[model samples]
Target: MAEKQIVEQVLAAPSRYVQGKGAIESLGARLSEIGSTPLLVADDVVWGIVEEPLRRGFEEAGLPVTRVGFDSYATAAAVDELVEAIGSGGHDVIAGVGGGSVIDAAKAAGHLAGIRWASVPTAASSDAPTSALSVIYTAEGAFEEYRFFPKNPDLVLMDTQLVAGAPERFLIGGIGDALATWVEARATARAFAGTMVGDRPTRTGTALAKLSWEILWEHALDALEAVRSNTVTPALEAVTEANTLLSGLGFESGGLAAAHAIHNGLTAAPQTHGLTHGEKVNIGTLTQLVLEGAPARDIEDFIVFTTRVGLPNTLTEIGLSPQDTAELRAVAEAATAPGETIHNMPFPVTADAVLDALTTIEAISRRVRAAHGLAEPTPILTP
Candidate 1:
């Protein structure tokens, strides 16, 4: 057999990232840098919050703008609708303003339309803002596929005040999502797997992933406190940027392994429907640690971090019980499915191995929680 050739490495990122309080108030200037006419895509709720500033800024800058509401999931149909809505209007840019799904939809639409785009995240809930890919879901919210773009967003605009004013759960969710970057990147590096950017991990991606983990460990608690008070503090800013920018670039170019694969697999369980992406990834991180046979101290430290940030640290906390064997098996099978990034682990992974890891990690998490006097988590169930 012939040896396969691979690219050495790749690093990808948005061209511009601006973060600060009242950053959206400068939207017009930023838009002008890209295009004079931009299609603004946001949901009704987010539009209500940002409309005044967005319209005023554009007017002041003498830029023409078109507004459309993205009320559906990031489904193929939704992207098609967005494309049609863009129509023959001669829009030069697409700006997504809201949460992950809205940003994803906008990215997909922009890619299909062959236009540049920007991501304006109103909440620090996920690492989708700075990436060049979108997770498309079925209209009913089931995972469908990942859609990759030729380039990352042209701009990622973060309004710290808007983020801080969001409900604290969003920030906590972002922390949960950011938690897996280093662990997964390390595993991918060991396996020499190709990253989402279509090459080997670059030094920049590796450093960013490690630094993101360090920031979470050092600043997550303080950042959570700041969000609770609706105040923008240094800790809050650092964690928010770590969650969005660092984690975004890290995962895309550093690659993913079992943690994100497990998160995708977990979507098979209906009991997990109410949980956020980061929350599930947090549990997946614990499972990944156990799967890799990490040291007890390391697992314990991670559990403590998750607990402090109010992330689910156990199966029960994530709405699964020891007796849910069928669901567990489904998750394991899904995690180990063909094309899943679980194969990016240095070791060959099996569904049975994932099942065992899930069980063992839950037991370990319970022990850690008890030792730390943490209350048992009340499971979140979908109606």
Candidate 2:
């Protein structure tokens, strides 16, 4: 039995990971070996920030490259643009370098190439870089269904220095997204039990998700300090990796639960449309915990960690008001779609209960934000 388990563990999708300060500079050579003249897809913001270094890397390695710039929107249109750029030119490989948007676009582009992709993330905001799935949005920026592919990334390159140097909000958002792994994975495991697909819910994925949560809970403060101080503390590195790589791979294969479902509900609000992906997911995680009957202490611990890290602890921050009860109800209903996140909860959840949880979550988030002297809650939108 133990031998069977060991054999199963060895069969998971493999990703070549490279981590360090100057790791990004070596990407051209590393990717060139796998495929000459790889297509590079990056958001405009990333190009402005890291283009010079990347250009130098390509020049130094004498690698042929085709660069495609995206506007940092992961919309279907953007994906189409990327595919068009990669074209029928027959590039040997595709590389996505930037945040989740660029990575998602690159992932889709590589899929179009009928080949594996190398993901280079400039921010640790979400797990998009490491997943075989792409959360493509509609052209108008509405949440769309997850797009699954036959394979995961060919490589995951993490330049800790570049990541540490990027805006602190990215890491905070990453933490927000990373926090969902344990919450979501556990919920899925409980719902489907041993029926989890393919070596997915692997003991490794489950263990990584739990450890990611623990690292976030215990070291979030230190991570925030590192971000503020512009230093890569060991805690920050661990948390960053968890958010960018581990959590991503775990959730893609392990499965999602109410946390992401709650995030999906955010699209119902125009105000939430402007928020970062992980930021919305952060609040969703809190709301999911409430639905899961998590203890007050455990939930509070999550709230405190989020509060310290600048994540939304309340819906009011995302622009939902008390009087928006009607809108919240509609959103809750949408979250309970069949085989969706809300249904994945271990306990039964009604739309009304979901509404109440959202209200509680919003209120708590506001209080935590206020106490930390963060942004004030804003008024909600009404027709």
Candidate 3:
């Protein structure tokens, strides 16, 4: 194999993305382009919310769609089981209709089955709906490994009404995930790091990452407020797109850095299993900024905004304490483990440095909380 003179630029995303109220009602029509007999991947919880529209759509299209129950994390074993089950069912396509873990599991299973897959997110809880990679986890929910597919989902349909109907925590968590896009992308760009696509970031991917952040920075609070009132506004719509699509493409194509690496580190702690992916990633983003020696004002600004949106930034908030040296050290070690995206930082990263950065952010978070009289985030996660 000859070494290339330049790193190939990459920008990965779903082949098609559709978002609006009642978008899932059109799922049967859109998915027909990919396959006739499709498998719907969702758990009982998700099935309860989307069953009507999904069944109606398929029935109207005069097509057969089978349900694939998924309630666990996207573990390797789970993916293997799903692949075998799907192969036996003769499903030509798979469509995940739930949150991050379900979508990831569907993507992994569909890829292994050599069948196309679609994403039908009922909640904007994380940016997993449009990517080509499955973040496989352990049965206990610890970070396991990443499974990549040949392409992104064939269709990504985000029903804003359904997203709005979900518990507000989902949207908040999604915002947290979207917030990391720009921060991680900036670092990846700074270091010219490799992406999930096995290539360097493109200008287009970086631009989308920046846009995702800007959208959240502008509309997150408003979107949260609207969700609290059980209403879907323009702010909510914009935020949903930012969290689902922009962040998905940005992280996959633009590359990841310490933020996501730190999130994986958090998974090493069992106490944090209840927290959503975006919540952990939000904490990771703050830690990454600290590790980078970013401007104090920038860090404080992030704290201020995220605090208002209820992102947990302190050790205690995430079920860790400053006194828990062993656990914290474990997290630091995981963040700096071999092949972790923390290496994407322009500077060499060590577990000790990551540990120090975590401590620094705790103090910074405390200071910001005191100055603003802000309360710690409530409802750490949703069911």
Candidate 4:
């Protein structure tokens, strides 16, 4: 048998990112730089907020525009519908405006239609804006699979004012999503896992991941406060960039590990239905630390950071009861399933190991909360 060759490294990012208070107002000009005839896709709520400005801007720029409404999940059917619409209209560019689902649908549609695409995020909810990937779910909202595109979006435009005005939960959810970047990337580097970008982790990706983590720890609280007040402060801007741009590039080029895999596994439990992706990943991040036997100081620091920013540190917070052995085992099994990203860990991880980590993390979280004089720990049911 011959030894297999390993590719060295890969890095991927959007062609450009423009972010500020009035970034959306420049959408027409940005589109003109790429194509003259563009199609806009957004959900009802997003369309309501952005319609006038977008229409005015495109008209002023003398660009032809076609608008479509996306009100369903990012299923293959939805993408196909958008693709047909774009093809029939002879639109040259695709612009997605809204949250993760809307942006993902537009990206998949544009990829299928062979058109350049742009992402305009209305909230800082997840790191889905800058990546060259889309997560397709069943129409019923169950996890299906991730689809990778040939190239990243041509543009990612974020209006900080819009992001700030979004519900605070979305911002915190974004923080939780960004929170796992450094931890997972470090594990991926140690395991020598391939990134979503298709090769080994790049120095640039790892550096960005580290920077994202540092910014979250330094500015997350202030940013949360700023968003609550509907004000765009420097801290808010930094965290938004960290959660969207840096985390997007970092995760795509650096790779994913146990945290995200655990998140996927958690979806198997119906109790987690109400939790956001970042909220679930928040618990997965802590669970990963426990699985890796991370140093106590490091674990405590993360617990403190999550607690300060109102991220879920225990299973109960995410709607899982500790005593549900069968459900917990299912989650663990899913996490360790074949082809799951949990394999990206530096060491071999088993379902049993993940189960044990889940229990231990609950105990650790309780202790940390008690020591901090925060709310009393929820009673853990012995398995």
lDDT of 2 by residue, 1-383 (tens): 46555323311343677777778888887887688768888766777777777778888889876777777567777777777766666776888888887788788877876766888998777877777767787766667776666677888888877777888888888888999988888886676532123443566676677878888888877877887787777987888778866787567556677778788877777778777788889878998888778987788778766766778767666777667888788778767766565665667777788788887776666666566566665532333
Off by over 4 Å in 2: 1-14, 193-200, 363-383
lDDT of 2: 0.75
Each model's lDDT comes to: 0.89, 0.75, 0.89, 0.88
Q: Candidate 2 at 225: error in angstroms?
A: 2.3
TM-score of each: 0.97, 0.89, 0.97, 0.95
- Per-residue CA lDDT of model 3 for 235-319, tens digit only, reads 9999999999999899888999999999999999988999988889988999999988999889989999988888888877788
Query: Which digits, one per residue and each the tens of the lDDT, describe model 1 over residues 102-206?
Result: 899999999998889999999889888999899988776667788888899999999999999998999999999998999999999988898887789987897
lDDT of 4 by residue, 1-383 (tens): 99998678989999999999867878999999999889999888888888787778888788876788989878899999999998899988899999888899999999998999999999988888999999888876766788999899999999998988888989998999999999999999998898887789998998899999999999999999999899999999999999999999889998999999998888788777567789889889999999998999999988877887878888777667679899999999988999888999999999999999987787898899888877754422222
- Model 3 ranges off by over 4 Å: 1-6, 376-383
Backbone N/Cα/C clashes per model: 0, 3, 0, 0
Listed per candidate, the RMSD to the true structure in angstroms reads: 1.5, 4.2, 1.8, 2.7
What does the lDDT come to for candidate 4? 0.88
Where is the poorest 10-residue window by lDDT in model 1?
374-383
